[model samples]
Target: MEQDNRTAYFYLFGDNEDFGMKSCWIRNLTKAPEEIEVKLMEKGIPPMLTKEFCKFPEGQESLNKKNLEIVWMEEGDGAALLENGEILCVIPSWGGDRGFCGYARDCNGQGGFAWELSEDNEIRKRINNAISFIKEWNEEVNPFQSLQPQILDYYEDIFGESEKYYAIDNSDWPPKGLYVYEGTEKIVFATVAVSLRPQPKVEMYYEDASKVNRIELGIILKSGLTNDEINNIASLISGITAIPWDYITFVAEGHTVEFETIASEKFKYAVLTNKLKLLPEMNVPAFGNSHTNFLWIVPVSDKEWKMMKESGSKVILDKLDTIGEEIFSLERQEVV
Candidate 1:
């Protein structure tokens, strides 16, 4: 579909002289590197590498690197060759404040999309991935959706087949949903497709590298909980997985969130962690060049929450190690 340039304001009009650019979000738009360069050159805007994201644009470090390909978008960020053999470019902006990421066809582009030619095949791959991500988002498609079956297979291999699955379709925000694996001793409430789409801008809130990787949330409990309790657990995990998209941010290890209601009265806050202690080691399945991680949601008391906010998830986890690993016990005592 042809897009009206008006979709983008603060654009380079028929002629411009400010020597600056502005951007608007885009949908179903793409231009070849040379085409972008020629368009800019027609206006005498050389596609030179004027702005270098030495650290990569503000949010580049944590974007869906796998999808946006932030890693291969390296320094000495190359230029998009223009009609004059150059194109002005700002490298690696998809991981920026905006959810869209790719080559900003308009120079004044999607929040900040970027791409240029590079001899290095790795950089080429990164640029290609970024372009693909933006296109997918614009067309309202998720390339990761194909990973669902693979995700299910992974869970079954590690956690055993689920007794039941809830929210199996994308009627809600996230296509991924919750799975219940009933065991002789305990029931595992885990998310399967949550990891299919990596959480947005995770590095901004977390120093731990693991948070950036795709992750699935899990909650384990002793068997024999009432059906009402089972439903509550399933609903909670399903919602928690969508928190990143819900809040337009991310939740990582060492992060804590208070809930008005949860599975128990003693716990009002959830302390998320990946450094498991009592639960069995969950080996995640590899997808393409990467692997997903499993993060367990451990319920905590107000006092424990305070300690976690003060020190980190470590303090709370260590205490659990000493006091007890009762994360599954809905009626357990407060650790603090």
Candidate 2:
């Protein structure tokens, strides 16, 4: 037999209705769709979509049906069973080219939206899956439609009506909207779309990775700060939301970020914390999977950051509390 190097590598993230979102490489299924031949298996398929198969698993991921077993055909080709546990008859994808792509099955909507994008009006005959799964998405098939509203609702439920909701579509349609909630003494700003995907090495953060794999960042500001200060905070929150995806790492409690020679030079660094003194009710998880953890960004000075690294964020928190230092204020006194 000749060497067949074609292999579809995939990684599953976030389960919805027992269906998972998957990312794959080896071929771009969106630009070129291919179906695999059916093959009956004597046994069931193992969990193929894992972090092990997808090291440094970056983008190229999307929604996928979960727990369905697969049967492999000759020459690196495979077939995924539908919810009914039957294989759909399909053509041989490995014949023409010896490469891989995203996984999809005609039944149960195994593949995410990207595979569906390729099944345009012209190639309807070649594809068997229905596009009904994308009803929540916009006409352009935006995936964030279903996820963003949950965060919006969460903020509204806890913080009441936002005086001004600032969102940008530059990166994603709901590019981490900063919901501005006004209070008599303090102001709150919570980000909306940061948890659309899981973080890298999130498993190390908690035993239940699903519960802690995702996060939403927030910062409460003291009342009477200048408009420019508030806007600077908004810009900072929006930028921080992209850090995980942009850097492929997870931000959790105790994580600290230092600002460069940026505009908001009042506070040089920040520490991630969950102890929201203003809105005690806002510290809960915001999603069905319990994946949305809220981390408050408490800014610190250079000396304070050095002290925090030496003693820890908890000690810093205690030191700040002892001095009656207001953590929500950008112009607050340094505790170092």
Candidate 3:
């Protein structure tokens, strides 16, 4: 048997950032293909990726409907099952050449306005809601409507000639400040950074048995400076910034390090949402936006945890009521 090389199946939800005011139309891209088949031997059906498949141990009986599994050992050809028992195999065809692409009818009454652009980042937060609304309206859309001319007209206005070097088309109307990279299997959609300035650099570190990469931010005042003078400086910084002084610590380490304040976890969110406008890795696991710096706190063994608490180095401090071990961050701006 000739070997086939294809990636395992992965589901797509569609892209919103690529389309603008009509961004709501993004959700129509999620429906399964009318006919999906793998090439080569052409008879073996693919499996479904359900919750059971992700949970069950790997093997053949694990290939049951409850644990729909697809193996990548053979590459190229793969299969998948629809909820209603329809089997979609890997086959060769024009549409199958570049994987799959299908048109969906707009079921909504808003003049096929299944997808619409949102006012702000509100759409990103309510993506699931948007998908549900569009699915309900897909049945009404006319997939056969001639959109090529309209798409051409939109691009001609921007690039003077819509044939090539154009930014967008009718098939995929990306929103401003969004990028879309569609693949044969999965699609990746991301919101581009809005800042004219370049993105900042970030470094990550995980502590093991002997060393600590986390640094504590401490502010120092001159020895001659009165307590009132120190307090005034502290108040000024706190007011201008979201960093809380209570979260900060004052340590007199000779003249080199005078006053220190531990930056809080809340400031992390504020910096990313208001300043950067991009997601960071550490906070990606959580749904909300990320701050200027990305930091994840992994707990050490209980023995180390107790020793650190008594070390008096102020290695671990809790500002956001983060009960277990904690992590803090600092921003790294480009030098222009």
Candidate 4:
């Protein structure tokens, strides 16, 4: 994908300036000993200018030993041909504030997405996986509909023997309670113990040398998010993990429902990773509802965490305590 000239400059210098000629000057310096005279003629640079700029600084012998090729790119269009005629790989610059990552195709006219490119191939693959998770989320899983008592009971009947039934879908599963499957996508009625499983992780690299990735799916009951939209999300994200559909549960508290699962504590950290813009603060019913916003945890190694930071997911270093645990307390009240 083409990127902006600013993206390229930012990649190289981590900043932008008109005199940003580091990459180019480095290139000319390397060609000095053998091709300096000839190259200066081609660029119309006086031989004296080439000699002065290409001269090795003290303890910088590596400049003479190296070969560098610099290229120019159109603003916002990352495509460029290096002096050696090689096209650099384009990687997206992730903006965490936007909750997504992709390339910046507009630079001021230098052709590169960034200066140092490493593992972007892997990062791109992971970002694609993240998008897939979002798409799948839109397809399956009724965030609200999964909460009815009837639905929870349905799964309970299948697995609640000492509730020895961990496998709710077993053919021998018996319906010991009310079996209700309301057609409304947002509001379901069932007496089963439903569970919400975490979604798969997406790993993508960004220009910051940091990595970007996400786990599970978060559905903010944004305005206009209908019952159908929530259900579609559930269905799409359902089978991405081994956590069975029967284990996923959504609990209703009023006009909205929150999702969770028996395995939630393990992956609850995902909530901290994604920003959740709750509905506009209401003055009447202060706490919003009588329950906590849902959460899920995802186990990742320190290496994975570091890689995640590299992709632009800001490290919550000083605030690990603030994550996983919810601070809200809603007191149940009857709706008139």
Worst 10-residue lDDT window, candidate 2: 88-97
Which clashing pairs does model 2 show? 22-62, 23-61
Better of 2 and 3 by lDDT: 2
Candidate 3 lDDT, tens digit per residue, 1-336?
011122133232213331111111112112222233334227653322222212221211212244333221111112122222322221111112222321111221221212112234232323333233334335553211222233334323422441222121223211112222223322222221111111111111122301121111112111333335434434333321211111121111110111122322212111111111121222111111222122212212333344444662233222212431122122221111
Task: By TM-score, rank the candidates, best first.
Answer: 1, 2, 4, 3
Q: Which stretches of candidate 3 lie over 4 Å from their true place?
A: 1-30, 34-213, 236-336
lDDT values for all models: 0.53, 0.52, 0.23, 0.26
Write candidate 1's Cα lDDT for 256-334 as tens digits.
Answer: 8764244578787787777657866666654445556777877788888998788877877877776444667767777
Instruction: List the lowest-lDDT window of 10 residues for candidate 4.
Output: 327-336
Name the best candidate (by lDDT). Answer: 1
What is the per-residue lDDT of model 4 for residues 34-144, given as tens digits with 9 covering 90 to 100? 223556448844331122232221112222112333232211111222223223333232211132212221211221212222344454444443334334435555332
Q: What stretches of model 1 exceed 4 Å from their correct place?
A: 1-127, 130-146, 168-174, 203-211, 259-262
Candidate order, lDDT descending = 1, 2, 4, 3
- The 10-residue segment with the lowest total lDDT in model 3: 194-203
Clash totals in order:
6, 2, 45, 79
